[model samples]
Target: MNYLRGEFDLCTGCEACLLVCSNRAAGGYNPRLARLKVFRENENLINRPLVCTQCENPFCMHSCPVSAISRAEKTGVVLIDKEKCISCGSCIKACPDQMIRWDKTGKADKCDLCAGNPLCVQYCVPGALKLVKKREVPGK
Candidate 1:
């Protein structure tokens, strides 16, 4: 499986990735609606892209009362079944990385890897975000 990796060193904090991601995820242009978040630290010298790690044991998935969230078996991507979602905010609170967000419609949002190719990776001019095969390390 290939998980997306974000590099803070190459990030310029331009927020182009956030804009595109928000539009795609929320059908709008609000950064707050985007699944991916950029955290600026060190006086904006570092831009950390906070995305869903697609964890082996995702808390968001387990926290959903209605089973709205699930992992895609084919892609290893975590996805939300919007119709099944009741907007209870449990998944939002369960996320450790704080990547899940609330869209204007009040539904929880998170990255789905854009079904395969992520727009954030495509538009990242600085090469900060990348899609790479998962490397298995001993005991990992």
Candidate 2:
């Protein structure tokens, strides 16, 4: 499956990805509301974009009491079903990366990869983000 990857050297700390992601997720331009987060590190020498890697053993999905979270069959994107969610925040708490966010509607929200083409990937400038396929190791 294809997934979004961030390259630190290519990033320019523009935060365009944050703006577009927040707008889609929060219906407003708030970086805090975005699913992914970026941190300016190394004394502002690097901007590190933190995104959900869609883990093989996802804690968020397992911690969800009502099974609201699941991996999409085709995309392998972790998703939250708002209808099934009871706002218990278990999924949020279980995430090691803290990618799960609370939406305005009191439901758990996270990156769905925009169903394929992520707004963050599209808006990311300086070629910091790219959609990549999982590669098979030659030795493996």
Candidate 1: where are CA atoms >4 Å away?
135-140
Tens digit per residue, CA lDDT, model 2, 17-92: 9899999999999888998888898799999888887776789998988988887776677789899999999988
Angstrom error of the Cα, residue 130, model 1: value is 0.6
Cand. 2 Cα-lDDT = 0.85
| Candidate closest to the true structure, highest lDDT | 2
Each prediction's TM-score versus the true structure: 0.89, 0.92
Model 1 TM-score is 0.89
Q: Name the regions of candidate 2 deviating beyond 4 angstroms.
A: 135-140
